[model samples]
Target: MERLHKLFIYRKKLVRPYIEQLLKWMDIITYVMSALLIMTLVYEHGFLISFQEIGVINRLYHIVWVVFLVDTTLHLLLNYSDTRRKYRGLAWLLSVMLYLTLIPVVFHEPEIQGGIHTFWAFFNSRLYHVILLTLLSLLQLSNGIVRLLGRRTNPSLIFASSFLIFILIGAALLMLPRATYHGISFIDALFTATSATCVTGLVSVDVSSTFTPEGLFIIIMLIQIGGLGVMTLTSFFAMFFMGNTSLYNQLVVRDMVSSQSLSSLLSTLLYILGFTLAIEAAGMGIIFLGIHGTMDMTVREELAFSAFHSISAFCNAGFSTLPGNLGNEMVMHGHNTIYITISFLIILGGIGFPILVNLYETVTYEVKRIWHHYIKGNKRMRRKIHLYNLNTRIVLIMTAILLIVGTVVIVVLEWNNAFAGMSPTDKWVQAFFNATCPRTAGFSSVGMTTFSMQTLLLMVILMMIGGGTQSTAGGVKVNVFAVVMLNLRAILIGADKVTIFNRELSHDSIRRSNATLILYLLVVFAGIFSLSLLEPQASIMALVFECTSALSTVGSSLDLTPTLGSDSKLIIIILMFVGRVGVLTLMSSIIKQKKITKYRYPSDNIIIN
Candidate 1:
């Protein structure tokens, strides 16, 4: 009795104080281990198939698979008391999905081929190859989710999760038998998933020839989610159904939208969301009527096609279900309907949302004033209501400049080179569409390879400049480029401050603008340098153009995608992700864990010529 009482007292003394402390330490260690596992997976590069050790590659993949499964199981068991079961359920679901997708690969016999890397040989499976591909894709998604979910709740987590999920679904779909699956290849599927999630339009296979109606529908959905960004869409819906949005969620939406935060961000987002859908619906209606009258499709098919194209176009996803892309139909018929409709859609979508809102408000205010004046028999009405905001003015001005410059350059340079065979009207239309689409829209009326070197260079410049912020379009953004140029001009003129359209810039805005410019250039250069090493024989101009297009998420390629090795494709993937999420934010996400000091040190200046 005395021993039992002493033991109970000792247990009581030992348990309570240390439990929470122990848990905290365990959480930290689990996070670190998870991160270390992710890093190992990234660097593994896996075994190549072919050559002497094809079987080895398959065995290695299986080993890695087993390792991940064990790790996942252990994590679930260890965290059972503190962590929610939902996480374990997620891990289980992920594992099941991966194993299910890889079932087809199990039937294939590995064959050794000469000169192939051992890792490549392991990936070799007949029809079952897709199984391995599907498993790898799911792993990526599961890892992304697990990583983000481990962190504190934030809006960025939502974007990261959605992006990963879309890729996983797209990958699994591609792994299905290609014949019944509408000619989809594993590479094409991965590329499409990456492009849509990144909102880059670089396609490995022709979208029109291969994708079934269901597949095309999937592609369109990706375009919409990718273009508007998943976080922005989800947050908008959340705000509509629920009155409140958390600050962390709002921050994620702002980052996704690339907004400047002039007013209540939630209200602005609501307006933008509602307005965007309305515009897209109207656009679909217009295009449907035009296409229905022109083509001989059934009503249901026509409506589906119209809706798909409208959403994709408005979102600037640049995906088309039509055979041979836009260039094909243009070849069949004269450049009359398709070019005009698509061009108009691209133009409207390229304009930033804030500008669209401003334009609507301006027009509505003017119309109301005019109506009131007419009723009272007043003489005049104002032409403009409240001067256009900085964002609006910059977008409009830069857009016009780029269009004019691009048109002139294309006409002058390509007139003799690629445009030699076309009529004057067709040539102009081709040039105009090419120029406009590179900002965001991926439509092409002419072969990319046919363009002159000068024209391609110009395209590189325009693509790097990209479209407006808070718009579906990607790139460095025209507004940022314009601000940088204006600042440079101001400095050259020896002005104390940068001025634009009779308004002085805020110091903070100018600093951010400059930083954005530098960061964008650095990213482009790094992409180009990396790609050049992978394909030494390719022209520097062509490689840079491709890199810029990927960085801009513009989807314009010079026919280099199909021939690129796995290394090059991975590099492009990185560029596309960076392009969608600004370079600044990507960098911040990496460095955010390290808290910076609040105190400022003394500053020093350097002289420049």
Candidate 2:
């Protein structure tokens, strides 16, 4: 026994260094394979598939798959304890899948041709092989992104760069021959790609009529990635599979999710993804049920519509599979349930993930405390809990106030104008949707151009206010709007400090908010001015609406979007990019300003006003 123990120890010592070296090489090889796999998928699906090319594609796919399988197996074996501890059943499931993928290799030719034999033969068929390869490709792609992100430090830069990369890739894919029914220009593809990647949903061409199924799928993927933020998704996969999240990674995640502490970063990420999927799934079911028998679509088509709209609504992307967007009779009439459910999803998504996490923790804590007090008869367990943070309080209060006031304002202004032909119920529903949509959702149940000038102006304001920070929604952000308002109120009241919920707002926070607001306005004004010059035939009101929509990342647009000059579209694209990545973040990423100064400067006051 002693001799065996000594031998085991010696073996482990010798293998440790070699395992580490192998892992480094595996990382590089895995990334390269993932890129190759993506290229393969693009080539196969983007163009006409020839019978002769099938064999070559199959061989390349098989080689990449074998490498991935081996790499994953070795990784699991080398870090079994860590993998098991982190993923537990997931690790076992992956192992099972890997083994299952090898069945075709093991049994190249089966003698039997019926019953179970037939099933096995089908499983080993080319169709199954492609499906398996596709799954492996997605895994490798995710793994590659995670590894790449882990090596980066600046979370803001990574966040910005990831969107740019996704936009470029999406554009390239959309330009493929099979992606669009009629071949699209590169600029149009780039616009569509940026629109999808930024989750802005502003399209130069009609999505439903122009893009093929494959192109639509790519657009959906971009929306999902854009809405969730690439860094969050990549990090979740990394922490889930690797379980070796470094402190630097934790720090970056902490900032990205606006997490209060490093310890809860991983849990927070899990909650974000879990909540998103859960909400989207529930929305999908309701939407599917609502639109099933009403539309002319088959089961598969209805399912795709539900999934696409559910994702788009939850992401606040505003992309609809229907030609007329939400204004289509299919969604606005018998599908009232779809409209209401989508509205709920828009609200939930626009509310921000950090706020969702806060609500989750608060509810869970309170539930546990109540259960302990009632069931266990322990008064000590029911100690007072301060569940709401300042940010959460401010966001919730602002969001509620905005939604309520905006709804009321819209209902009143459009009661006789835009709501003239609709029933009271439909009127109220459309009014509520308009209110929420401008909170960066971008969906509209009524024609935007038909609205009264008052309603249109109100929409511009609501779009400008937008939703919360660290959310898929974009604008000046609710927090920034709140801060700016509080500051203005304090100035009017002659208060020395901006205070909210008995907490003094920090100087830096106020400054950043003010700067962001000013910069946002400047960009909007500049965009409007430029568009006016480029498209002189467009009305001033339409120009302002489009500019605000673009700057706020609200995809709503007048009929002008499709008719704009290339210069105007380019301006909108730039606005969408800036809006998705905040003005402040984009500025910081571009110009690396020093965070602190070594020396202090004297302050001087200049009289004005």
Best by lDDT: 2
lDDT of 1 by residue, 1-609 (tens): 999999998996787467556655644544444444433333232212254454554554455555454544554554554334233343354555545534435644336655443434444443343343334334343333433433555444355556766677665554444322445556567777778777678877777666666567667777877776666665554443333334554555566555558246667777677777887888788777777745667899889878887887787777777765677652335634556667667767778787887877777887787787887766665456445788888899889889878887898888878878778887788777788888887766678888877788788888888888867888888888888898889988999999876789888878888898889899899989999999998888779878888888888888887678778888888787788777876676555456679999999999965
For each candidate, what is the lDDT?
0.69, 0.85
Clashes of each: 13, 0
What TM-score quantifies how close candidate 2 is to the native fold? Answer: 0.90
What's the distance in Å from true for residue 542, model 1?
2.4
CA lDDT, candidate 2, residue 190: 91
**Local distance difference test, candidate 2:** 0.85
TM-score of each: 0.71, 0.90
lDDT of 2 by residue, 20-42 (tens): 89877986787787778779878
Query: Which candidate should be chosen as best, given TM-score against the real structure?
Result: 2
